[model samples]
Target: MGNNEYMQNAVTGWMVPHGEHSDIVMSTRIRLARNLRGFRFPIAFSDEQAEEIGKLVSDALLNGGKTGYAYTRMSDLKALGRQTLVEKHLISPQLADAVHYGAVLLSEDETVSIMVNEEDHLRIQCIYPGLQLENAYRKADETDNLLESRLPYAFDEEFGYLTSCPSNTGTGMRASVMVHLPALTMTKQINRIIPAVSRLGMVVRGSYGEGSEAPGNVYQVSNQLTLGKSEKEILAELANIVSRIIVHERKSRELLLGRSRLSLENRVFRALGTLSYARLLPSAEAARCLSDVRLGIDLGLIEDVDMNILNELMVFMQSGFLQNFEGGELTAEELDSSRAKLIRERLRQRAADGEPHPDEP
Candidate 1:
């Protein structure tokens, strides 16, 4: 599998949920930066060693690392670990070479998360489908074996690591879905939205929304009540918001989708549809094929086109009969012919229908 294709699958297949899990995700995660904390061990582990990695991490928590999660604060390591391993120059500052590359203090669970944080500390996030599925499977596994383990252990495995406040039970897991509502939500409305979301037992923050912010537009909302609320209630709320958000988003797109929008929308839908069938080939190769088509048009050698349509086209072309093309290399004649034909067809065929448009022509 190629990188781009893998990236695509990792996003669509693993990150975005399907069927019943749809509302569980806010959106694909966008990480803008990383906060790295290095650590060194005076001694390296042997080949035969089990590498008390988990224990060392647990014991090393005293160096002022806050809970790797937002909800899990420095004062609270109960959900993740007893402590986090983010001590910089905390030990033996005088011992110069006793350690290896300091271990990067990743998040509480050590799972990479992709969210942008403005703070000095770095954060990571995983896309919704990817992480949610993982947690779901773990929860199902733990529940399946409920008779064998202790209640606390089992619950923590399913929720956000057992919390003192029972509301955060069963893996302490809460998922939020987000929407970028700049058009629907004015700056004044944003202030109101926060308390509104919080009031619904949903949490909201800046774009990128849940964990951090990125340059891209996104807003996340996750469930707040873990124990009291049944999974059904949380999921229902997520679904409702997602539905409403989709309506708002569609309206926004309608307002913004321009002359070629209909064609572009069709093109994008085609690409997204094609993506699901790409498993027959290596994913990266598929992505590259799609990327080439996109980049070709983007470079202006292929033709004048909407980049968004191009992106969507990438997904469609991946699994189609002809899935590969670079956007570079459009000759003047080719451009003129395609453009003229496109324009003429639109004027003759569907422009007068008073329908939204058949812009692709």
Candidate 2:
């Protein structure tokens, strides 16, 4: 398929909300980093070798899959398109900006993506809506197995998977979940809970994973240690921790409603007021505002809004996605104005549908 078509097609069915805890648990992701037996890491590869590596992984991914599987050469896409993929979490920023050859194999559902020639020969990842760790891991393991049958991965007698990063040396697996913790943030409990989670061999990363800020009260919790543990053990441990966090978040929400209903509603309504009336909204402000509205929906204070729309806005309202959606570059002021306009339109449409808004009662 063509580039624009590929980008649009990749988003199909992928961003829709799913799972029982989907209101709070945004998504689950499992990634396995792997390199081929003889090929050098992406950084060490020459021009021709990088091309060969990309071809090898791309071809193998397409070998037995249906049309849902797509291969896109990173170099072929425009810079904006690559950034859009990054916003969608389908590819990494490093892979998007790779100098040498790089490509990605994406599932039609947009849940599975393999970054070829990214730090490793392959960075295979599976994403599922809501708190579905086991489901995400199942798909990731299947894809890894299928690829392994066609290509021999670099492995050591002592380590399971030989990766460029020492931390990913064994198992080479990273399991994470994106969650909304507005209650914790609103109650100032996140500060205390974060260090405790760190002690449990877990990390609370920003919304888009490492090195990003927790915009919209969204955080990604993932395993820190990958060495020495079996893949099954790692998944089990991460799942247990995530479940506990989910419980905590739910309880916190209940507490807020029980003891501080008026205050919570006031904050949610004030956010809605700014979002619907603002003429210019910065990316960060929009994220934080949308986060409150999303929490309102989760708590049944807002009936017109849906989690699916909130999830889509989480990505589409980003600066890169906004520029790409408009099909051209925008000045900083223009982007802010456009983001506000978009938010107003979305919230207005939902309001016009006759559902109860947070400000109504």
Best by lDDT: 2
TM-score of 1: 0.37
Off by over 4 Å in 2: 1-14, 350-361
* Candidate 2 lDDT, 1-361, residue by residue in tens: 6534533453534467787588888888999999999878877878888888887787777765636888898888888889888988899988998844888998877889999888888999998888888888998999999889888889888877999888889999999999999999988999988898999999999977779899999999999988999888988888888889888899999999999999999988888888878889999898898899889988988766555667777787887877876779999999998898777766655563565434411
Error of 2 at 173 (Å): 0.8
RMSD of 2: 3.5
Query: What is candidate 1's lDDT per residue for 1-361, written digit by digit as tens?
Result: 6534533432233222233323223233222122222311223333222123322332333232435532222322221121111111111111112122222333433233312111212222333332243444343333223311321122332443333335554433455444434333422444565676677677765432335541113356666666656545666675565565555544544453444445544553453333323223343433433333332332233333333332222223222112112223334444333333322332223222334433342
| CA lDDT of every candidate | 0.34, 0.84
**TM-score of each candidate structure, all chains considered together:** 0.37, 0.93
Candidate 2 positional error at 192, Å: 1.5
Q: When superposed on Cα atoms, how far off is each prediction in RMSD?
A: 16.0, 3.5
